[model samples]
Target: MTQLTPSPAGTEGARDAGDPLAEGRSRAGWWHARWVVPSALAVGYALSVLFRLSLVTDQDHPTVSPDEQMYLVMARFLAGRPTTEIPGDQIIPSGYSLLISPALRLTQEPVHAYHLIMGINALVSCLMLPLAYWALRRLNVSRPVSYAVGVAAATLPTVLFYTQYAMADTPLPVLVLLWLIGVHGLFSEGSGRRRVWFGLLAGLAAGYCLLTHDRGGVIIALTAVVLLAALAFNWAPRVASALALASLGVMFVVKKLMTAWLMARIDGARPSEVGNAVFDTLANTQLMRRTVMRCVGHLWYFMTSTWGLGALALVVCVYVVFSKRFGLADRVVAFLMVALLAGITLAAAAGLPADGRIDTITYARYLSPLAPVYILVAMAALYRVRGWKKIAALGTAASAVTLVLLAVLLRLAGAELVKSYFVVWGLPDATFLSSLWPANGDWGGFHAGRTTVIALLVLAVVLLLRLLAGNRRAALATGVAGLSLAVFAGVASAAITERITEPRTKGTQGIAAGFIEAAGIRPGDRMVMDDGLVWEIRATMTFMVLDGRVWSRALNKNAPVPAEADVAVFALADQQAPATDSWRNAPAGWHVDRDVREHQFVVWRRR
Candidate 1:
């Protein structure tokens, strides 16, 4: 009505004109988008998974460690079929045992089931890569830097190696990472619906972490300190206090629910029995000290060992601390570092034995949850330099050189260490350590191959450095170097599999399973063994008939065998005095089935 002149075609065209270059830039940005981080992580993780699956051995099925076997038995019992007759030790955490039940259901074969559990763990761990990247991006790190960090994390040797194994350490890191992401979000945006949501998620993650492993409490403590600091800085005093209380309430509820569920699973004893065992383990003074020393030793080893990246992180941490450019993020990172150090120190001071028998120190797996924070701090410190491009270039060059040297040195050191240990222990010089190779089943070829692999790795590093020389892009150079190193590592890993694990056609699980199947063992048949192999047997067979009396009597000043035993499985066939003749010269009614295929396993059955 205001006599708006009809817009001319040219005017309309001018109005509709869009900046092509800007549009192009925006579209190209998707490649480095935050969402793409997870995709990249998934790719890397898929490769790792494929690599691990390729190396799977049905022959050497899941060899239960003394600790793993105990958990397996508990899981088996909890699955509603109590196979073992031995008095269930309350030493295993009820919470962890409860979690293992679901894992056991995925497969009928214990080893396959364990692998499936570990595979889930690995997937969970891989998901942490995206979480880590998101946190870094939220903290305002450049896209390239964030992606680089994710790649590094995804390919970390320690992470990759542990993910392939069935252990609590794998899931612990994932939960810790998720918790950290929630913590970071809460701190970055204080006191809102988002913050509340993050707080709840953090609580849930922390609670789940605790269910997986005991050291999750340490992760919660570290997270709380950060949230507290954020609240103090950003919110009104009373409001902040209220928010903190609310967070605690949420955490408490989650903890209570998890605890209740775990406690409900205890069949014979009160929940306090499990708690007491944990307390007793922690209260061991010698164990605590040794564990602390071991942590310190591992940290030292990580820094100085053949891992150049760790060494670089250590150097950067020292440099940033002294540079006087410390900011709030620096302080936050510093606090976490202090907390981890304190945790380790306190754990060590608790007198944990040097042998790692203490809960905190024994596994060293407890420290895994803190690993991401450590890496983040190191990366953040390096990023603080203003003219970082030049520094990054120099660092990349240095890293390349260091990596080559480290790889070579690691190979040489490993060979020497194996040679020394085997020679000193009077073990077979298997071509590959612990593998059935070298024709004579000795390690002579393994030592030689170890040296050759080291040399090849060094050469590969040299080639990689040369390829990187002309590359000016820091991100590109880092990617190339990382990928090259990862490839070389993969090759070396394959060689290890070929040499160490391949030759043993009948792995522990296969051997145990085969024996049980061949013996016509049924679901109700009881089997007793005086060795660690009993768990494998129990897993393969339907029942474990070994009475606690057998072990108890053996421990009681070498007491005689129990009168009720229908079958006896002795691990050590060489030791004769301990009922060896009685077993060897058994009557026709009591036949002896000697299995010397893998190791000497004797089964004495009453006819």
Candidate 2:
């Protein structure tokens, strides 16, 4: 059956034939608010992907966060290792790695393999834009707002940044969005067969999401709750509702069990009692407040960057509830939006700890998985507001003035919101706002943070005034401007971030590469790293040159070097030279090497 799309507000199921803009396809031409909008969005997304691809070529290896490095290693394992060599227990899920392993199999070169994995990630992330657009359209959002939603998903800095990195941050959002799309289909389709198929698809998508990241556990739980609510309200027939609920619940459980089995197999053993004890200890309540605070900070940070989309969503929800203009579909979207935000917030708060200090960088990464939802709901709210043209122009003008004034005032005061927030919370001030701080400090470090706060404040005030005054046009304008500023801020911030961090990441890669080259290590050569080198370096080494066998052995500096080793790298406390005691009586033709990071590499040759 052909998908039925509701006509836009004025079209009444058909376009004005005399209007030249309506001169495409049949009565439901994609250019007629359904297809054209998503197509345009796809074009924009493609451009962004191209831009990201251009940046990727600048470095020998793609930039990787620590988590990304882990995924890359897992991908490598999946790509090459024999089934028997796979371990029995995995701390990290392999779904994402497994998804990208095909790229690795196609290429033997580490850099090429890394590019392939990131290319796949970028493609998936780009596809999310259209997925979001389709989902919004299915939920009956207006054409303009759906386009905005798609654009936001495509261009948002966090979305774009992670897409270029080899991590599940990009994939999870797409998966969750797919699940939501399936859920929407399950409810909206009338045919029993179609409903059943949609239900199955929804269940599969949710399960796949769960397998990709533990965060999907929250999505799974939310699915059951939503299904229960639907059943309670008689939203669907008993048989259909029961089937979907059961299918989703069963899929979630099956995925969990399957993942556990796969992880155990890959890790070589299940987690031991000691590991569980440490996990329990680390999960103590004393850390909850900090984690919650950090997550809250991240949410606020995301909202600010997105032109206060979260704030706009709140106002829209309240208005929808009171105005009684919302149809069932709209109401459902609103409810699902709230549930997802709450679920992710609580999950972030509970699932991670601040680790004794504010790690401004890492916690924000968790929020990227929800970026598409945030963009969708925010845009959906805007679409609900009518007569936005004049108000949008006015709001944009007002926003420009507000931004200038705020920047001037902030520059004079020299205040940094990040420091203030930390001081209030009594946490060690980390100085940098993980996702908010302009990466290059190009915008005057902390000045950018201040400007962001002011921008959010302006957008919020304008939106509230428009809403309270019952000026729907102005409210619409404010929403549009807010979204516009959101894209601008996010894109600019990401570019600065890349510029600032690229060199450092490249430097790290260079150091690892230098060590590998100097060691004269060849394919299959055993290269042991000192235990103190940290996983970051170890992982980088593993990715930089995939051929060499790498391991970290907790050997003392004085211990005899393994005669089987071709090379050994040691992480020193400082710029200390390698002590000869470890290899004093080494076999003939042994020598040591150094890298800029104060690491010592020794290469051993046989006579």
Candidate 3:
């Protein structure tokens, strides 16, 4: 929200002031740069919101991925359940569900509650827009470049995809952004009181980030690393460094102590198997190599998905590091990025499955908090690129890289490399770019894939032009167009994926809900479900009636039915329909009361 004074017309540098083309371009740049790009960004925000709405049905409500149900179940507990009863099987922190609780408390309908949670996520995630702009401005990036960065932060496919879910990923970028800005302020601000306040605020933001997700601990650790780096290099005042460290230490210790206490209070209620699994997973270090490999792969896909912004950020950070005039804040930002890299690597290590699932899908969400910073660095790099010759050099290099990448992708179209990249990173698990540039089909996916790349390339080309003509007009126009296209790509991708996948997700939820309804599952009914059922169904049932008498038994072939239960639910492996036959292995005296076809689950009433 910082106000920037629009530079006067023709004040921008000119290569040939007497040349008609140069003069005209300068005037055009001045004219468009002031209003057009920002206006387009505002429009992108609106479109992003609408696209989110399109994805907000029961099918895509939380997400088809079972993790969303866990958040919902946790939120249900926060809304109206005893601490002892909350499921601790999932090791995720409670901050996200706690955020969703207010909305749930206001609405009994699950769908309405989901809508509110999505809206909250969208708003929180959108905070990146202002934060990006402000961060770029702080770095002395021009208005035009900064606006593009803000727009990109608002419209990137990764940001949009996560916003549609009720996960902790959405709010993380905002918290990270705040922590970055706060750290930046500690040295930038001159007044002692203001610096103290900034340090406290930064620490608080770091603490909250840690509480929201385990990756948040990375922020706090990164801040401490920055302080050490600063002291080692004599970058900032000793007093300021001390204050920042003190504030962070207090918050970190306080949060850990409080979380430990709360865990103890709820410990007796959690299943012993859950505790055993968590501790066992934490102690294992045998898979360290696999964890590192997945982390590296995750970073690669993250760069690819974000339109090469990650590469751009790396280029800028390298430039800053090698620059003779780089200062304390520059080192802070650079080290912060390093800390993130280390933290993320550590997170992936901690999250490695003892069962060897070892996929990086969840790690991408952890990496999302770095997106705004990536945008800021890229924008700043673009802003610093001056002159026609320099622009051409950079553009040529960029174009060459893009061409080689595209060619490699085409050549490897049916190869395992492309497929494995998506799998390792836990992407949709479909063929890479299959939805967009389908190897087996048409160009209809252009809006989902190529348009975004084309737009960014266009923006890159215009950045080169700005170096020669210093025309803000062309830069602003192409930048806005590029960003608009990116937004379109994101919305189109969301729509396409939703269309193809929502039916299955919705079908599962509907079948589960329908079966429960048909079986007349009242609040106090003793309901037995297979302990081996997907977490989604179990969590969904718990969320349906927080205080219900739900019990889990290993209801597989020959497993005994709970004598105290009035009803039970079971699911079969793939291709088998949910029916009485699906439960043929069930103990005698159980009659199928309802069958959920989509999910292959059945409810049985004791006869």
Candidate 4:
């Protein structure tokens, strides 16, 4: 049903059809070589992701608490249970929780239910693999390159580790990638009717993107700008853009309809949650100004996280934008990625409340959905390289390495001994980026963990230069860069899992989960969380003793406790706790069942 897209996309893609890697396409048996190869590759990638996530996702407890706790609470609420969080704090979207809700029904134990959600995470997140492979194909990226990038993208710790958490990020990469594909088809397809279909498809993905994560708003905004570009340039059919946008409008209508029914069942949730702080970002010039340093910090750290492929990717994107040699479609996609990188980085940089820690430098988690671009960027740079463009890419990459080395030097010079601050903000454990400190100092004589990255980046640039030399040079350079990145990513991700991600649930938090249960809390108990307890304690209490009927007293200490709640879970450090600053202990008229002073926790029952 598909016809050749307009040239030079068609012209360039036709050249790729003769690629030795795609030789099988000539033999179109019943299996249909075009679909068969990509399908097999997709299935293989999906299974690998599922298997990889399975090994580490079955944790005793959540590592990224509060965020995980919030998700769990949201899931239970979606699964026809009572609200678990304080009112006004539930600005979080329920899109990911909708997926997690089904798993809660499979087991009574909170941990088991969490594990089932992890399995669900693996399943839903792996959909990105197939979608990614298909997206690359739609973009007319060569078959071998598409499949290779698809598999390579899965190897990133960002792609794997987040699945262990119940955060919306688990499914974002796929959703974002799929939306981009729809945008491409909506604009570049030969048939006007097919274009409208693609537009509708894109819009649906865009709607889901909004639901899945707050960053989805940024994605939607980026799409709006891109669609406008399509209109101005006459790149897309007017009907297609209208249809794509209309689908997202329908999504809003659906959300509004669902909100009223949901509000009745789950308390404390906002009428509808869409974008958070997005308006403040645009209106406040100071907020935008403050984001500059943070934005650069986020980008620098992300480059480090990607092992320096981000630099090459940036160069490739810039080159694509200016180079008319690339077809309209290729350039537009390139522009989209580049824009997304900037938009996400800037948005992430904003609203990092003035904190003393240098957390931004280690924060790479924000733009991780763009992980696939690392290898793909270098590969694009390799594709159809000219003398001037190759020079420019190499020069830019070299400059990036210099900047990286300089940043490390500056860090060493102005370093603080805030070892405690290295604990990550979201996933505070060793599983996250902040925990990867340059130990023994950045100037540890001949050895520093940071130097290893710099060296690799320098080598990658050198290899790219070599790659541009000739066919013989290209073979050696390509093989070394490709194989090295692949092996490094695999080993690094595995080591991270073994040394870090695995330990999070088994550490203090896991012990705490058990402690909470042993301290007189039981599975499926209706619990009330005292407002005076700290966030960490609250997260653990909510997580360990879930019955879907958990309610927060919120900020009102005088607020009446839920009449049906069986237990009041309080922390020793709470304001109302005994021996607190006010010398207060226990809520009035409550009976203390267990005063576990050693653990700084207590369980109480209503009189």
Candidate 5:
């Protein structure tokens, strides 16, 4: 943890004399400059929304990120629906659903509601630009630099790629940034009243983040620790700490209440999902080896997912974090970044899908909330070393090459320490290694190995230019090249993902609703699904199902059924449900009303 130095009181945009981050006492509040006002930021917000909206395809439903179906189902419940098929155990936090559920209430058609939710996502996601700009400004980063970074982040694939999906991740980065800034604000301010306000706001952001996704749990925990430290260490006023803790407690109570309410309205939506199973991997002593391997793999995936840009950011952050010259807020934010990466990595490791697929090793979405930080590093690198030493810049360049070499080393070393873990688990998918050698031109028929060689040799050129030539232009050019490469990589990834996702989504957009309409299943109909069906088909069908549903295939075999069920969706085309267990499913007496053989399911209406 970085040492804390309390900042003196100043106006909203006024200069604070006690702030060590200040360039000078007179110019302390440069981030509060006339041009950086809220009205000026409106343009960036509008443009960001437009760009994201342009990315929206005709498909109103989820194309990727399977959790979208679950989210929308939960949203429907929150939109004042009386009954729901989704269980409490399977539901996500209510925060994001609260944001999008209104869309469902405002319109009757699912398509219209989806577009509205997409618009909300765009608007919410774009909040990053202004928030990022403000945060950098407060850190004493120059105005032009802050604005550039903000714009760059808005367009980056990490921000744009998820906007098309109706998931909490869409607004997550913004929420994370807000929580971070609030922490910095509360701790730095001199006024007790302002500190209280900042603390409450921080709690609000932290709590809502939890409501939006399970990852928010990490944020809340961090918030509690930070606040308690503030009080115990006498870093912040007692009142401020107390209030923040209070807000967090209140938010937690709200989460419980919301869950209880939703659960009561649902059928058999038990609390099993929140139990010991989630921590099974972490609890077992025998799995320690696998857990350690998972942690390492997750960390590497998070950094390399940005294709080495994060390595440079990590370098800059190391200096700003430990060095005494930087302000407490800057150092703390950096510390939280590292902490968040660690927290998410560990959590993902503990709750891994247990599928043993290699892609699970390098899954990047777990750390997507940190995307803005990489752009910040990229932009910060472009500036000359002012208060800091030149070693930071040089080390940043070297770090990128270092990462490339490490990737090579992993390939050479076969990552032997963890390689066996994969072999023992299941088939090691070589494709997961694609994260390490990104942009190797596989699609263009250029060999990945050759591309790796080219990248290594070019970075070598960059290092030599710094060490031998020793010119400042070389430094600036290097930063520009790195930033450009990062942008190019991000855009390429976004394009590839969109291209792959859009067509599939468009083709199958109407699966659930089509089946409902085809079979004339009414809104009040009770539905049952074959629990044996794979998640892809089941989630799709479940998303379109009417409220009040059951999961039982035994009903197809004349087993006792739920007291009421109007329709049953099963994969069996000609045969009845498999005689697995009668009590586990509902009773039979269904007439096949529709057979969508292409999807491998048929809708049977109760006779």
Candidate 6:
């Protein structure tokens, strides 16, 4: 048996001589190549999916976030009556609910359906890894460097966490990354036809973003500005113009469709209230300054809290800038980062209210898409350091640290802050990690687990350093080993602790489903649930309007309950309106039913 030696630089030069872009492009095709980064992303995301599924063990019944419940309720309402009041319009776009309706139909389980859709969203977002690598390579970065960045992005905790949840951030980032890749491709390899195709993709992305959430519109606007600036600088005027046109056309079409749908639904109902006073107040400098400050304060908390990894990377990038090792790409990245940061600041200044709660939630999830960019910039800075082994070692170390910290923070703090942050921002907390640490728990176990994970991570980093200084191939192998071990240990620890402390809520969905089935709902059977349980109930029975009472009460102050609901599902432990003898006393033929445990669901036949 003859042993084959590694290819020399001379042979590599010959390969490149055959085709200039060949070497760069070949990296994309390499087994552990830049393209393979998406595979790692897929693995991470798969873990996220499993973790989320574990949280909602019963597929027939699922535990959904407030926003998700809102979507489910709205979608079910639209599917049946087509004339029901659209719930949570301000926080979430109607398009999302509409999109989710089809998924709900397939699963026949609201929570399961929600997670399934979110998993798809997460998978789509992970696809950005390969697309981003393609863009980086097109920008003339080495294939290995590009691949490394791609892998880093795939394994990013922020991205992985959000990917498996039913929220706008999952799809929004995927769209943005796709847009970036298209923009890069248009400038680098696109002909007139390619420009047109790229433009269409860009437009579709912008439209999707706009329809998904209000803040998403900001992404479109920023994209337009960036494209125009690039054109002005002669980067690719024709391509930019095409993209601009495509984006505008798509936005117009999406807006028209949404408006038509809204108008059709609200034809007989009261018109949506327009508040010019609030709008005018937002234009005022004093109010704007206060709002901006409040938003910034919230943003600061979000950065330091669960998203500390992205924050740490950003801090590192800033440190790199001060060290005076900036390149042309770095400058461009810096400018784009500043532009995005400034845009967020300006948006907060323009829109957020002085009240801290509203501002924080509104802007918290908005920072997610920016997280990838922050990581990318940090990776770019890391790549600027000479020696491939150093790059690999540092990248591995940074990734390990980030993963460990995120896991620790999540386990210790619980997901209240994370969930609250997104809800405040009009986004859903759909990520797998978010569900791991529920609000009620000691959180000490999580803290302890994090400490252990971090220790292991630090050891892995030290081992990585040793591998780097000695043998090149061994360093690469060791880096991979360290990452694998850290991820495995972190996830396993979380799984075991979660299971031990809070075993899977047994057949929780069955009880909820049982209530719906027992109700014998009719076409015009109006139902109201205290905590939006009616949304889940709708999956089992037909109801004219299954209003989410809790969300309604929270969002609409002075909104009264309909006097003639066919059924009322109330939680026994509801603090808002506790179950009492008076509550049980209804009209003479009204029947009240209790579940297996401490739960009360009523069925009232109108007399």
Q: What is the C-alpha RMSD of each candidate to the true structure, in Å?
A: 10.6, 7.2, 7.0, 5.3, 6.2, 9.1
How would you order the candidates by lDDT, starting with the best? 5, 4, 3, 2, 6, 1
Q: After superposition, how far is residue 227 of candidate 3 from its true place, in Å?
A: 3.0
In Å, residue 7's CA in model 4 sits off its true spot by: 8.9
Q: What would the TM-scores of all predictions be?
A: 0.65, 0.75, 0.74, 0.82, 0.79, 0.63
**Clashing residue pairs for model 6:** 165-430, 361-424, 361-425, 362-424, 362-425
Residues 301-328 of candidate 4: C-alpha lDDT, one tens digit per residue? 5565665566666766776778776666
Q: Write the per-residue lDDT of candidate 5 for residues 263-286, one digit (tens) a residue.
A: 776655654253355488778888
Model 4: how far residue 587 lies from native, Å:
7.7
- Per residue, candidate 2 scores C-alpha lDDT tens digits across 469-586 of 3433432443364456446645553554455446545666644555566555576666666656555556566566576455555555445555566666655454455445434444
Error of 2 at 35 (Å): 7.9
* Each model's lDDT: 0.46, 0.56, 0.58, 0.60, 0.61, 0.46
True-vs-predicted CA distance for residue 280, candidate 5, Å: 2.5
Superposed Cα deviation of residue 526, candidate 6 (Å)? 3.0
lDDT of 1 by residue, 1-607 (tens): 0010112212321211122222346544555455664577677668656666666543234343434444444555556543343234333443444555666665555446665655555456666566666655554444445556665555443444444444465566666667655544444334466566666666567656655555655656666665676666763233433464466557656656644543455333233243344457577775554434445433433332223334344445444444454443333444455555456435433433323222221123344455555554445333333344544553564355444544553443443334332221111111222233224444432233332233334434533453444323333443344445455445544554454344442455344456655544444344544443344454333222211212222311244444554565655435434434434434346566554434545566666
TM-score between candidate 6 and the true structure: 0.63
Model 3 stretches astray by more than 4 angstroms:
1-51, 57-61, 82-88, 143-145, 228-240, 261-292, 354-363, 392-425, 428-504, 510-512, 523-526, 532-535, 547-549, 555-566, 571-607
Scored against the true structure, residue 113 in model 4 reaches a CA lDDT of: 77
Best by lDDT: 5
User: Which predicted model would earn the best TM-score?
Assistant: 4
Report the number of backbone clashes for model 6. Answer: 5
How close to the true structure is residue 218 of candidate 5, measured as C-alpha lDDT? 84
Model 3 earns a TM-score of: 0.74
Q: Give the number of colliding residue pairs in candidate 5.
A: 4
Candidate 2 runs further than 4 Å off: 1-30, 33-42, 59-65, 82-90, 142-145, 231-233, 246-254, 261-288, 318-328, 356-362, 387-452, 457-490, 557-566, 572-579, 582-599, 605-607
